[model samples]
Target: MNGVVQNDAWREEYNTLKEQYTELKRLKEEVKKLEKSCFTSSQKQLKKLSTIKKQLSKGTSGQEVTAKEVTEVEESLKKIRETLPQPNNLFLRSIVGSINVTIPNSEDKLVYKERYENFKRNVTIVICILSLLAIWIRGYTRLPEFILQFVSAWFYLALTVREQILIRNGSKISTWWVLHHYFSIAIAGIFLIWPEGECYRNFQMQFLYFTLTISGIMYLQFIYQKGQLYKLRTLGRAHQMDFVQDAGMRSRSMGDLYFLVPFLLYTYVFQLANSYRLYNMYYMQECQTLWQVPILGVLFFIVALGNTWTLALVLVRKYNS
Candidate 1:
């Protein structure tokens, strides 16, 4: 009797293990089927998205659509997007109906969208505060120049955060932005070490250094942006995109001649200023304040004239268009 009872217990244990194996196999098959279905659905959605993009591109411009038509399209696309199996598909959804989707082709679209909207709201608040501070700095408060520098540094730091977001969202880095980033850091460093209660003469020298540094950095940035534009045009041609080279191909006129001449003058002046400063530093000699004064004056005049001409040209083009 004891032997028979032991046999029955062993048999029951084997049966329980067999049942668990069967259930495991069933679950594995179900998962595979679900995965296959998901892939099929995703492919279908992608095709639909491509179709919509093509249709929108064919239209005159997204803005040309009637308000009612836009509303209808948006609602229909929103419904289809809502039915998608995964939230990662939101990037496709955004392109279907929106005209100016800035955060394109990002994998984490939802997270990025939320962050971008919050950033815009914060910028608006900061701008208002800065406006108030500017008024205060000019009127009620007689803050030291260093204090003004500190405030400017902080304001630029806030702007940097926004730029970082743009970089993460795959926007091409502009030369201007790259220089601005480094220049902001350099200015912040200068302010941190700047002596307290310095004489007005000393302050003026420091301010001049700051101005020269900023001008040099910005000039480099302009050159970089121009180069990037050229490269982009070349790329567009290689890709056979319907790119209009109207603006790129137009030969700059005599009105614009003054613009290029000044940039060349400024570059020369910047190099001269750097050389003079280095010479004075190395020789332990007092540098004359007027050494680069003439060059600076010329730069100022050229910048003003170039800016006026550029503005007039832009206005005329816009009005004509």
Candidate 2:
């Protein structure tokens, strides 16, 4: 009876051990399946993350990405990381950290710098031509306007070339010099194309229109240059000499004042010329019905005086200042 009892006890113990072993095997299988799924999910998440990182690095604007989309991607990556084994978790963490900083290519920077220099040079040439035209109209017309125009144009062109060389050598062209050059060219062009006589009156009107258009454009440019100068001066006052060293900034300030003087002169001349032509036409046609000759004369005189006074004041101030 005792032996039977002992055998029964052994059997019960073996059954208990068997049950525990079966449970442990089942748990191991489940853990293996979970690990496999985690690995697959992690791989997918890594690939998606890599793609997103590439897009970001390619200069994608923040405006194009939505908060919701970023959150979703981040959440997915987080879930994947949580399931990943310790070794892979470290790798994913490394990838996430590295994605934020981008390495710039020196070659691309060089290319952009070259393109900017080319643009500046072209602007300088246009300015030079405009200067020649202005000077020619101002009183150099006897030397065969075209020849004088050509020589003056070439002279400024040479100056621009020298300025460019100076710039290349690390010295900058003065803004005043550039403005002077461009204003002279523009004035020259206007004078060269000014209309005279009935035969060319219409042409003159057209040219006047063109000059007005150019004046508007130049006015805007002048304003921009002035703003730049103001900022540079402010910076200089702040002890930011680095701003002063910028060729464009230094040139723009002087250019602004230089251009402003000529611009005022050109405006006066344009108004005077247009008014005279209009009066002459009315007189010839006997259609002076609107304005009396005296009134027109007074208006013209006032405008001319005001313009001359303005120019004189400007010069005086410039010299004194």
Candidate 3:
């Protein structure tokens, strides 16, 4: 009798689960139908607007009526788009194959954004630690130096993908910030493949020191900038999606400016110095044949110039605002 009772209970639970599954399937179909309907309606609205535009161009009189109609159509179209799912950009579409990257829920988006920021902070710590190890080892054959480059390359690649996702979710990351990572990836790759010899030995310690210094500065910037962002968000001056890692200077105060500018300038100056050293090294009798020297010099110089210019623009914008 107990066995029979257990079998009946199991059957009832299975039936309940089956009913819930059926309801979920029906709800999914309804959502798909709603999406299709919205898209079709938007297409129709666009066609209607195009027709009106052509009619206006053809000199159909009633100019005020035409203008009013155009305004109404555009407003309606905007509303329609607001209701529709945002289409993914080419970069994101290529990787994720049409899956939406936009996190519609505010809390979920905040969690993802914060996670990315935390990841960068942790990676910065790792880079700093490895850089110090590389400096301590003090040799071209050291594993820490090579591992640091590899880690940097991987980190930047990950950053580029994450930033693209963040942008889809309404984060205002600039174009240069994304491109900067690509440049860093290339720089790191160059460092990795750079043959171990006199040329490598010449720059290895300097590179490690530079990495350590920059990582420290970056970690500091992350802390201060994150605090500034929180303050700005509280005061309604900054968006929640705005982050420390973003290239823009949205929430930056004069205090941050004073704190950040000199360090950043020094960082760029170091890059320029590195570029100059690489340039001089290229013409030297021992290093002339190495292809990585000139390419890296050019890359470093480009990044330095871009960064300086971007910083200048931000300062100007901040002052003006």
Candidate 4:
């Protein structure tokens, strides 16, 4: 009898659990339906708000849609967007072929962004160390320089992808920084493929030394700007997604200007100097026949101009704000 009773008890417990599981499954479906409904509703609202904005921009007035109403609706739309998930930007869509990069969980998003920043810093350090070794070994057109070029190309490619991910996750990284990496990739590729000859030998040390110098500058920027970002975040003055840039590309206080601005200007000047040297080398009998010289010179000139213009705009905005 006791064995029969135990069997009956187990059967009853199993039935209870089965019922609970069925209810949980039903609830999950219901939740999914509600989420879809909300998304559809938000889409409709966004369309309506967009129409209202267009009307307002055209100086059209309506009883139901005042300027204040449109503004409020726009704000509501922005908040709704914050709650909803988004996919990668158009640039990433074109290149990386569009997978959602949004991190839904707040804690997970923060952790991922922190990891991204650390990855950049670690790569910078690795490149700096390798550059130093290359310089010390004095292998301008040999294995060391080749290795550095390969590593740099890979680093820039990876960095560009990660920055895209970060941008998708709500980081306010500038377009110029994104383009800068693309340019760097191209330059690195040119360096990787350029034939080793008198022209290569002439420009090799200058290029390596410039890489080391910039790496050092970037390291210092990372150290100082990381602290600045943390402080700004703590004070609720900056977004959590913000990361350090070698040029302090974001609008910030003038305090770091005294320390970082000179270095940034020096970097631009160095690029220009490289460009001029390349220009001069391209005319020399030894380098004149090389196709890489003029191309590299033009690229360096453009990069320098872009960097200076971007920094100037950033500083101007900072001052105005």
Best by TM-score: 3
Worst 10 residues of 1 by lDDT: 238-247
**TM-score to true structure, per model:** 0.32, 0.27, 0.83, 0.82
lDDT per residue as tens, model 4, 1-321: 455454788899999999999999999889668756776888898887777788778877464668787788777766555545455567677767765565656687789888888988998998899899988987433788888899999999888888877766667777788888888998888999999788888998899999999989988888877877766777787777776663244436677676788998999999999999999998899987888899889989989999999889878878888
Query: Which candidate has the top score in lDDT?
Result: 3
TM-score of model 4 vs. true structure = 0.82
lDDT of 3 at 56: 83
- What's the ranking of the predictions by lDDT, best on top? 3, 4, 2, 1
Clash totals, every prediction: 0, 16, 0, 0
Indicate whether candidate 2 or candidate 4 has the larger lDDT: 4
Q: Show where candidate 4 strays beyond 4 Å.
A: 1-44, 66-69, 79-96, 139-141, 246-252
Candidate 2 TM-score to native: 0.27
Top-down TM-score ranking: 3, 4, 1, 2
**How many clashes (backbone atoms < 3 Å, residues ≥3 apart in a chain or on different chains) does model 4 have?**
0
Which regions in candidate 1 have their CA more than 4 angstroms from the true location?
1-142, 174-180, 197-200, 203-275, 278-321
lDDT assessment of candidate 2: 0.49
What is the Å distance of residue 273 in model 3 from its true position? 1.2
CA lDDT of each prediction against the hidden true structure: 0.46, 0.49, 0.83, 0.81
**Per-residue lDDT value at 301 in model 3:** 98
Cα-based lDDT at residue 69, candidate 2: 78
State the displacement of the C-alpha of residue 92, model 4, in Å, after optimal TM-score superposition: 3.2
Clashing pairs in 4: none
